[model samples]
Target: MLDRRRLLGLAAALTLGACATGPSIHADYDRSVDFSSFHTFSLASDTPQPGAPPLTWQRVSDAINRTLQARGFTRSDTPDFAVGFTLGKRDRIETWNYGPYYAGWGQWGGGPWGPSQTQVRTITEGTLTIDVFDAKTRRPVWSGTATQRLSGPVSQAEIDAAVTSVLAKFPPGSTQ
Candidate 1:
């Protein structure tokens, strides 16, 4: 019973709702490593993509700093772990094709189908990867990634939320 305008509006609302939830966060760590032993961390010399926007690294670093501090970690010159991140983006294209599979016509067929239709959308997806390396081994012990569709300029709170969501899995264990 929905008209074309109504259907389009509903789709837009659903897309916006998905965007509001921000990015999807994922984390992975060496199960053999004891995260409890990690008490102090230092910002690694690693930098974001050299061509990245000037403030992207600053914002990401600040957000990571705040999140780690809140999780009972300290910053030190000679640290247990080195924290770093990488930023990247890519264009994603999604296409949806409906109909042509059934014997149906546009409207009035008494069937719930329409004419063969196709919708193609391109979304810019941004990825942020946070890595934690053992200072002594200089190898990664944990990594978290956040991926989301980028629509416009991002805000600090959004950055913080993305960082927080990823690191929430830190010190991964049954107890945590």
Candidate 2:
């Protein structure tokens, strides 16, 4: 016996909960490569995208540096592995259908099924891909990708969270 307003509010809340669970992270590394030998890293020179904001790139780089340093990897001019990352964003459309809500039996059809509701919204999704390559051989050793729904302009806090979530699996085996 819920009103239309309350039912719609509940549906919106459920949708938000599903969307706000943070970034989806995935990581992979070469099995033959001994990640333990990688003790130092240097940031690769990356050309910013033609129309992208500079601060977003910088924020990601800073977050990578902080995360790696905390994991006991040092920055060096001549390094074991080189780190690089790319950022991308795209618009996504999400649709949710909330089926009938009961409001007590009254009409000839016994409550009229409350009328099915469909909600649609457009969201921006951002993705960050971080790659680690062996400086000597120039072969990739480890890579992580994080994807999340973004809210307008990207913020440093969001960048940090995404970077941290992605790199938490770096080196493959050890707890980070």
> Which portions of model 1 miss their true places by more than 4 Å?
1-18, 46-48, 101-114, 174-176
lDDT of 2 by residue, 82-140 (tens): 99987666667999877665433565556555787889999866677899999999999
lDDT of 1: 0.74
Clashing pairs in 1: none
TM-score for each candidate, following the candidate numbering? 0.79, 0.75
Q: Please count the clashing residue pairs in each candidate, in the order shown.
A: 0, 0
lDDT of 1 by residue, 56-145 (tens): 667778888989988889989999999988776666799988856454645564656646778999986777788999999998899988
Window of ten residues with lowest summed lDDT in model 2: 9-18
